[model samples]
Target: MFTTGSVDGTVERKAFFGSMIFETVKQDDGALGITTGVENPVPLVILFLVLTAVLTMIQAIYRGLKQRREQLLEASDS
Candidate 1:
């Protein structure tokens, strides 16, 4: 993503995909500007998969413990 404001108070914004390689240019008013590059989606996908697996394991453990507690209570009552 890139944003810029002109002397006339008009602001412009843009977004692009792939890597984020940027170049800084010095304008006539001694101001700075940025340029963006490409995008990468592999890391995000892997993170999603790992989080899903962790949540599934936590839910399974919780269910098992709840069932065990119920069985223990039933045995004591009998």
Candidate 2:
């Protein structure tokens, strides 16, 4: 007969081990294309990289225009 504390400990251990087993199964060699509902995840990463590059280019252009305007104002004021 298991006491309450032992039962609780066993349950916690089981949960921990269960998660480890699940992760191992997920990483198995033949597990790549067998899963459902989950995507490959690489395309989303590529999309983010492309968006970041575009935003960086836009920021560079805006900064260049701002600096040019400031230079023009300084030249006129001098």
Candidate 3:
């Protein structure tokens, strides 16, 4: 979640990451305003890639086991 508003003369930018909140006040001595959303997207991208790889391996293993089980069942029936 993200939001922005003007507080006094400073522009307050806020973003919520799960339970963590980041605030950036654009005042003369304060920090610069943050982006409306994610600041560093690299970590999220890496995590997505890792999860995708793991799930793919799991799916492949499950399919192989199921196919083998079906083959054995057919053989036993015949």
Candidate 4:
């Protein structure tokens, strides 16, 4: 994809070299558009971080419960 910007009867052009690309432009009429692009990474990174934190918290809770169960079993066996 290629991107360029121009205003009020001006012409702009650009070229991109990659599997995918993004193009944004502003027209004289104050309208804008993103021509092409996919898989924006910033939002994905944020989602990944949130999921990781939740999984870590769940694992910690599970470990705590397991330890408590073992302690109770040992006390009962004695």
User: What overall lDDT goes with each candidate model?
Assistant: 0.62, 0.49, 0.63, 0.63
Clash count, one per candidate:
6, 0, 0, 0
* Model 3 lDDT, full chain set: 0.63
TM-scores of all candidate predictions against the true structure: 0.55, 0.50, 0.54, 0.50
Ten contiguous residues minimizing lDDT sum, candidate 3:
12-21
Candidate 1's displacement at residue 11, Å, is: 21
RMSD of candidate 2 to the truth, in angstroms, is: 12.3
- In model 3, the runs with Cα more than 4 Å from the true position are 1-21, 24-36
Give one digit per residue, the lDDT tens place, for model 3 in 1-78: 223355534343333332233555455665565544566666667778999999999999999999999999999999
Which of the two candidates, 2 or 3, achieves a greater TM-score against the reference? 3
Tell me the tens digit of each residue's lDDT in model 4 across 18-59: 334455666657666666554345665677799999999999
In model 2, what is the error at residue 30, expressed in angstroms? Answer: 35
**Candidate 2 clashing pairs?**
none
Q: Where in model 2 is the C-alpha error above 4 Å?
A: 1-37
lDDT of 2 by residue, 1-78 (tens): 112232222211122223221112222343322222223455556777999999999999999999999999999999
TM-score ranking of the models: 1, 3, 2, 4
